[model samples]
Target: MNLMYLTFQEDAPLYLGVKNKIEGQISAFEKLGYQVTCSMWQDNRFCFFGADSFQRPLDPAKRLMKQMTSIANEYIGGHPFDVLYLRLDRVSSDMIQICKTARANHVKTIAVEIPNYPYLADYMRNVKYAKTLGTKVKTAAKVAVTAADDRLSGRKLKQYVDAVVLYGNKADSFFGVKAMNGDNGINIDRIEPIPHCADTSKDIAILGVAGTLWWQGYDRILQGMSTYKKSRSDGPALKFVLVGGDKTEMPEFRALVEKLGLSEDVTFCGFKKGKELSDIYKTVDVGASSLGCYRRGLTRCSSLKAREYCAAALPFLYAYDDAKLKEDTPFALRLPNDESPVNMDRVVEFVQHCRKDPSIAKEEREFAEKNYDWKTIMKQVLEFAGASMK
Candidate 1:
């Protein structure tokens, strides 16, 4: 069987997690005995991996959407793939046309994955990513042209797409197709569990890891820490270690830290991987998942960070609704789904409780194995797509 996997992310550091995930999904397909070809757009060219290796240069003069639709039509018309899987770049008319092309070419099992269903706000929020006057103006101009483009495009999804893969969502149908819902899974065998290292005698270390736009609602953490610092001088010291976030959006956070006098307590370790990341994980007492999802107009989600934490057997904290994890889940501490400050005292108690609980490691690892493994999750996705699963 031959599978074609398409990712909309460029080959860049900012998209490293998404790239790694694509690799994991392809690896799962191979393990399941399928010949896989992966495609990515980078350096103004379409880069395809596996038995089909080629680079198709994108026209620079025409707009991006036009180029992608033409490329999808030309390529799918010539290729034979048993399954055509696309990681949608939000909703766009180009994507609708791309799916239409694949179906018209008699391609079997065409499916698209939308990371967020009501993602228009998040998509429009990209305009705030500009750090300079030039980029700001450019992004602003692009937003004006694009804000209305995706609205009607969503309705066309059901016409050609066989399945819409949704993660950690309870929705039965989306875009007029039955959704293939699952957690944001990890390559469990590849991701070694972070050894449990909860030492609460001196200070408890809480870790947060994310890429691109990590909205953990750390402002609430800062507020809690500030209150904790003012209220008590020495309740088992708490330290926050944040990993992977853009510096362009760090100013306000930095200023908040300064204002709260927590500059010395929070440590930022830009980007880490391999052994360096492993070493940091060894020192972490607990991990942090998305705390400010409500701010993004999200009430529930399947967090990749939470998945990584569970795979690492790291006990963690989260506020919003997790796809598989419940508020009563023993291995995790759940907070309120609001913008209020996280209570530092309660956090300390939670850390102490986690450290004392002997079953934390076992429960966390078991939970990860049960729900967050890529092979199992992808098999279900493949089955839902009407593929002849082995």
Candidate 2:
């Protein structure tokens, strides 16, 4: 079988999360004896690759149908793809046309990896950080209009796609259930999690980010750390080493850290990659995960950071109450839904306890190896794909 994988950030070198996911899927599909081609957006153009992939840009400000038609005429000239798989986080009018055009070309199956919430939810959340009224108003209006367009697009895309693949085990009710619903014989696949391994270790907790964008709630970490520091003068010092995200929210995070008086407690390591990232990971005692955002709380998340922490044999501190992880899961410690000072104090205590018991980190790594290995995740994905075909 031949498959075409498409996502927005296909060609970018950054956006580690998107890159890891796409690469994992591609590697897995190849192992399953399928010819997989990836089509991604990069450099204001669409890049299609399979040993000899090429890129072409779409004319901007064109209608959705026209855009799809113009691209499809070129893309589908060689042969029909067996499946058109989209790994996008959200739906858009252009996405609807992309699917429509793929179906029109007799692509046997269409699939999308659905996230916990619409992309608009994330956009609106980020808009809260905008300093200027004009910027906030413009971004908020665009998000609202996009959200409406996505709703319409989703309703249409749901009918066109043969399968909808979700990440976590649980469904997010706030995201609206129309796309996730399997009422129309649409194959729904909830693939297993994938693990990210690192050779490094550290004694301090690390909240790592790449590029600029504050989706992971770094501000709350400082607030929590300040409370932990003030209350636990006698306890061991809890140091938070932040890696990356300087470009995304360097100014805001820097200002917030100063306002909270956490300069002594937290350290910013700028951006680290390759050997530097691995070296730092070795010193890490615990890995920090998201505290969710203001809008959705911590409902259903597929935290790549948490998985990496576990893969590196580090205990993870997560704010979300995950239904998939049983109470006995040794890999993670759950924090309160709120990132309040009181709750963060408990998180600090948990870290201290983990520090004393070094075995917790080893056990966490074991759990990650057993459950989150990419090979395991891909097996499930391929099995679901096979079942869907039947």
Candidate 3:
């Protein structure tokens, strides 16, 4: 089967999620003995035009449709495809017509990739809930606006596609279709988890945090570490490493660490990528995954980082409350609730155990290789796509 993959919005060179996912799937399908061709929009003038500037409402939609239609008409006029896979946020009515035309010609399957869903009003409600739970609502309205925009964009794209390749089970249920999951399949086969490189020399117990600092449970980790340090002064010095830093938001976190007298202990490593990141992971004894419960319904969605953590064989502490995940994932130390802080004693005890029993780390790594590896996950994706394995 000839598969044509389309990604119009995420046209970046390095950090484009949609492009990377599609590329991963394409490579997997090829290995499974299927023909795949990716048709992506590369805007040479995007940098010149400014990313946000070009993302303005109707004007860009019209321009994009015209460009997409012209290309689709010229390239696909005579050629026929079995599957037309689209990773579009929002498409013009004209673009829908083009897809319909393709479906009429030879495209038997049309799958749209749904990466995320945002419920703006629900998020606002969540902000209020967070406030009730004694958290600040600094950017509630802004978060709501962004969430609403994504929801509307996703709905608009769904109207034109035949089926959706959902990134999560929650999205699959939301779309009310037989959705294929892609989270497991869309990474480079041998790509190690966060803090990529292994550094065995560091004696200090390294705890790596990769995601947003202000996110749920992150402060918990910091608080727990502070408590642990205060309780046990004689133990080995534990270094708390923060990766993937948004410099603008670092001040509040730094202040919190200072207030707790953890300045000497906590080190913000800024952003490290490729082998450097892998090495950081190796250096760290333990990696902290998300510890927040799904405040929004979106938590039902599996985290890409969680999968990466599992892949890297890093024993993680997740705050996921889904029953599906609880069923049989041995790679994570799942927390019970989002708001309830993790027990500092338990964390300290676990760390001590890990230090004493190196076999615990070995077991976690083995679990990752068996279950969370991209090769294992993508095999399921290809089978769902009807690509035959050789």
Candidate 4:
């Protein structure tokens, strides 16, 4: 089967997690004898004009519309695809037309790869429910605009798409039941567990990868570490090594570390990849996933970094509620979604426990291999795509 994968960003060097996921999917599809082609937006611009045109100021929205028009026309004119897969963070108006056009042009299957639903209104409600005073004020206006845009896109998607492919349980919680209702007329599909990499580190260490920090809860991590440190002056020595960050972001994060008095405990690995990353993973006993919500109130996330840690045979911790990872997946540790400092303390203890029990580490690696293998995941995706054809 000929398949097309579409996403906004394809830069793997900067966005390691997304790159790995896209490549993994492609690899899996190839193994199943499916031909896959990927198209990505560069510099957040879908279509670029000549250098002269680029030098002058241009309206971004207009440019996007023109690009969308061109892409739509091309697909309409190009070879017929068995499946058209969209890796979308949120639904948009232009996407609705694109999807409609694809189906109109005899595209057999149209599926969306959704990590989680960014329900801006629901998020605003969550913030209010949590009584996070300043947060509500800071995000109110942006939330209003995003919620309006996404809801419209989401509704259109429900009307047009054959299947909504959920990366994790969080997406299911947001849309699964609705999809099943006859009134909704939407199919909800889950991504089969993909295989994880093996642990190659020799020492016990905690690993962290810094991406866009705002929603990642880096500050919470430092606060938790500070709380943990205060609890035990002579606790087991554990290293928290962070990898990835640009020049500007590094200084901001460093300031937070110093402010929390965790200078000695936290080590910034700057940016490393390939062998250096592999070596770092080898030393890590636990992969420190997200500490809190990407959005202040929402607990749903399909974290690619968490998968990477699991692949590395390191037990991972995430402090998000309603993540839907199976209980039998003992490699994953879920912390309470609260502001309590105890969560950090628990993480500290958990890290030490995993260090002491080789069996636990072994279990994590085994689980990753058995569950997250991309080859198996691709088979499931193909099956789902075939179902969509029916």
Candidate 4 per-residue C-alpha lDDT over 1-390 given as tens digits, one digit per residue, 9 for 90 to 100: 677776656364557656667777776666677667666555554432211112122246565544644564465335566777777766777777777777777887777776544544444764464457676766776567666777767766655576666643333322321221000000011222222323333333567786656556666667767776777666555467888865646788889888888888888887676677777776556776776574445555656677667656667877664333764456677766655443555665566566556676567655556666677665665565453322
Model 1 TM: 0.91
Per-prediction tally of clashes: 0, 13, 11, 8
Task: List the candidate 2 regions with Cα displacement exceeding 4 Å.
Answer: 10-14, 57-73, 76-78, 123-141, 167-169, 172-203, 210-213, 246-248, 294-298, 342-345, 355-358, 385-390
Maximum-lDDT candidate: 1
lDDT, residue 378, candidate 2: 57
- lDDT value for candidate 2? 0.61
**Candidate 1 whole-model C-alpha lDDT, 0 to 1:** 0.78
Per-residue accuracy of model 1 over 1-390 as CA lDDT, tens digit each: 888887656787666667777887888888787888888888788777889786788877877557766776677778888888888757688777777777777778888887765566665576777689898888887776676777678788888878888753367777678886656888887667766544667587889877644466877888888888889876877788888876766787778889999989999888887778878888888888889887667777777878888888888889877668777787788988798888878778877877777687888888888888788878888888888676
Report the lDDT tens digits of candidate 3 across residue range 1-390: 676665555355333333445566677656655576666555532210211122222235466645655555545445676767666543345455666667667676666665544334344665664544335355575565556555554455444456655553344433344566555433535665443223333345445544345454566777777877777766556667877644655788788889988888787777666677677777666667666545544564556566556667666667754432564454456665466655656654455555565565566656556655455565665456454356
Which residues of candidate 3, in runs, are more than 4 Å off? 8-23, 39-80, 88-98, 117-162, 168-174, 180-182, 185-217, 234-236, 321-331, 382-390
Could you report the Cα RMSD, in angstroms, for every candidate shown? 2.8, 5.9, 6.9, 7.3
By TM-score, highest first, what's the ranking?
1, 2, 4, 3
Q: Model 4: which ten-residue window has the lowest total lDDT? A: 180-189
Q: Between prediction 2 and prediction 4, which has the larger lDDT?
A: 2
Note the Cα lDDT for every prediction shown: 0.78, 0.61, 0.56, 0.60
lDDT of 2 by residue, 1-390 (tens): 787876656344356555665676687667666688886665566677885577777656764334544564457545578877776667777777777777778887776776544355566775787789998998888788878887777777655675566643345332332234111010012222223333223234655554544556666667767776777666556667887774646888888888888777677887665567767776555667776443454355667666666666666766665544665566677765564532555555566666666676667656666766555565565455442332
Q: Residue 77's C-alpha lDDT in candidate 3?
A: 44
TM-score to true structure, per model: 0.91, 0.80, 0.69, 0.75
Give me the displacement of residue 278 in model 3, in angstroms.
1.8
